[model samples]
Target: MMPHQPSQWICAGRFPPPYDGQSLLTQELLELLSPEFSFIRADATARPPEGRIYAPGRLRLRRIPEMFRYIHHLRWLTTRYPLPILYAIFSGNPLGHIRDCVTFAWAIPRRRPVVVWTHNALLSLHASPLWHRTLHWLTRRATLFVFAGRSLYEPLRDILPEEQIAIIPNLVRRALLCSQTEVERKLAHADVSSRLRLLFVGHMLPEKGGWQLLEAAFLLRRHGVPFQLTYVGGWVTSHDASAFTRRIAELGLSRQIVHHGSIRDPETLRQLYLSHHLFLLPTKHPTEAQPTSILEALNAGCAVIGTPHATLPEIIQPGVNGFLVLQHPREIAEAIAHYWHNPNLWYSHARAARQLFVERFHPDRIRQQWIELLRRVQQSIPELAQVTT
Candidate 1:
C-alpha cells in the first residue's frame, strides 16, 4: 500500500505580541500540532501601531486596514492549499465575529471542513442579541467546536450537538512545569514558618478582581494575619491604576502588598509560581475561559484560591487542590484564612494541585486528545489534490 499522506491544514489565529491567554493558547496549539501535519499559516494578529496595544474586545477603526491584510493573506493561502481543513480560533466579541464571518465566507462556499476552537465562555455574557445571532450563523457550518474545558460547553450546547463539541483543556508548556523531585521538595517545605506568600497574576482591572483581592488582603491584615500579597500584571486603564494606588495607601496595605507591573520573562514567572504558597484569581471577567496562571500554580504545587467562574471549579476542587469562593472580599479572605490556619491542609492541597495538573492538564494528555480530534476531522473530509505552483 502507498504510504498515507499527512493531512494538510490551515491553522488560523493570533499567536502573540500582546501575550494574553488566547494568543498563548493558540501558540501552544501550533507547537503541539506541527511537524506531523502540513499547514499554511493565516495569522490573525492585528499589528496595531507601535504605541497602541491590541484589544481583542474593542472595535478599533485604525485596525480595519490590518483586517483586510489578514483576509488577503488567507485568500492567497487558500488558493494554494486547496481544500485544506480550516482550524480557527473563535473570539467572543462582535469585532471577532466579523473576522470569523469573513474567514468562513471563503471556506463554506468550497464545502471545506472547518474546526472552530473557543477559549472563552463569553457567548452568554454578551449584552446584545445580535452577537448571539451572529455567532449562531457563523458556526452553523462548522464540523467541530472545541472548548478549553467542559464547563465552557453551556453557551454552545443549544447551538451545536454534543458529538460536534469536544472538550480539550489547555496545556502548560514543559518548561513551566516542575520536575517530580522539585514538586516534592516544594510541597515538603512550603514556607509555613514565614508570612504566607500569595500571588495574583492577571490584569489589574476591577473585573479581574484585583480590587477585590486588595480588599481581601486588607481584611486578612485586619484579622492579624501576617501575609504578603503580590500583584503581577499591568493595569488595564489609567483610571484603574490611579484607583489601585489610592486604595492601596488607603487600606494601609503598602507594607503588605507588592505590585510588579507585568513580568514577560517565562523564567521569572515560573520562579514566582514556585516561591508562592497560594495563587489567587477571583476574576469575574466576561472573557475568562481557563486562566493558565492557575495551571502554572498547580504545576508548581501552589494551592489555588479563585472564584467559581468559567472552568475554575473543574480545576479547583474545593477543599482539595483549592477553594472556589464568591467574588467578595470577605469570602476570599476567609478562604485564604482557611489555608493559613491549617498548615497541614495547605501542604496536602499543594501536593494534590500538582497531581491534578499531571493527570488533567499535562502536555502529553492534551496532545493525544488533539491528535485524535485532528484525525477525526481529517477522515471526515474527502481528500483534494494539492495545487501545483
Candidate 2:
C-alpha cells in the first residue's frame, strides 16, 4: 500500500499519566509520526499544546460531562481541520467505552474513517450484546481497527473483517534498546553481590500480580536464592497500595524487595531497566492485552518473567527470551531461582530478549506497520478520502 500524506491525523484518547500502555503508545506514535504528518491531539487529560489541542481534565468525570467534552472536542476538530483521520484509542472503563462510541457516532456523519486502537480483548466481549452489534456495525463503517496483539483478534474477528484488523505490537523508544554489552557494563557498575537482579516495573496492584510477585520473592528468599526485587510504578488505587505494602511486610521481604514507587520520566525508566538483570511482570489481569514494560525490559536486554496470560506468551518465548510461569507463586519462585543460579543462561536469555525487542517492538518498525495499515484502510474506505480531501 502506498503511503499518502494525510492532511492531518487527530489522535483522540486519554494520555500520559494516568500512565497507561495506550497513552504511552499514543505519545510515542505522535513523536515518531508527526514529522511526516500534520498531527493534532485531543487528550482526555490535559489540553494539548496550542496547535495540537487536547481536551482538558482527567477522565474520571461523570458520563454526561465526558461525552459533552468529547463532542465539543470533535466539533472543534471538524471546524479547525479538514475532517482529519480520527485515531481513537479505546479504554476499558465504562465511561471510556461510551466516549469511544460517541466519537464513532460523531465520525460517521462526517464520513471520516475511524481507527479504533484497542488493547483489551474483553473490550469487545464484555460490552452489551446490543453494544457489540452496534460496535460491529460501526466497525464495518470504520476504516481500520488496530489491536496490540493477535490474542485480541479472535473475539472481534466476526465484527471487523480480518483485512481491516492490524496487529501492530507495542513499540518502545530507540534509546530504550540497550545492547547486551551496555547492560553487562551497567550490571557490573551496579556491582550487587546477588547473581540475579529481578525488577518489576508496573503498578503495585493485585491485578498486576504484585502480591503474587512478593510471595514468589519470599519463597525464593526462603530457599536461599540471592536476588533483589524492585517494584516500580505508582499505586493507582488505595486497595492496591495497602495490599502490596501489607504483603511485603507479611512476606518479610523488606530487605529483598523494595518499592520504588512511580518513575514517570522515560530516561529514568531506561536507567532502571539498564541497571536490572531481569524483568518480572506477573500480571494476571484478563484485561491486560500487551504490557509495554515487558517490551521495555526486553529492549533493555533483561531476562523477562511473565504469567501465561494475555499477550505474555506472544512476547516471551519461554526458555528462549524469558520465562512464562503459571499464576502459582511457587512456580514464579522456581523460575526466578532457575535464572538466578545460572549466569550463562541469564545472559543468553537476555540477549535473545533484546533481539526480540529489536525485531518486534522498535518504534520505527512498528510505526511503518501502522502507516501501511492506515494506507490500506484509506484505500478500502473511500469515504476517508472524502473527509481529508
Query: Which stretches of candidate 1 lie above 4 Å from their native place?
Result: 1-5, 47-55, 83-86, 106-110, 125-128, 384-389
For each candidate, what TM-score against the reference? 0.91, 0.86
User: Please, what is the whole-model Cα lDDT of each candidate in the order they appear?
Assistant: 0.78, 0.70
lDDT tens digits, residue span 1-389, model 1:
22324566777777777665566777877777766665666777765433234445787787788778877877776665554554556776667777777877863344666777776675553446767666777667677888888878776677667988889888886667788888888877677645789999876667788889888999999998789999888665566778889999999999998988777678888888888999999998887888888998999999999988889998999989889999999999998988778888899899899999998888889888987887777666545433211
Candidate RMSDs in Å, in order, are 3.3, 5.0
Candidate 2 per-residue lDDT, tens place, 193-294, comes to 365788988655567777787788888888888888888866555565677777788878778877777665778888889978889888877468888889
Specify the highest-TM-score model's number.
1
Candidate 2 segments whose C-alpha is farther than 4 A from its true place: 1-6, 46-64, 107-110, 123-130, 179-181, 184-193, 379-389
Error of 1 at 12 (Å): 1.0
Model 2: residue 26 alpha-carbon error in angstroms? 0.6
Candidate 1 lDDT (Cα, 0 to 1): 0.78
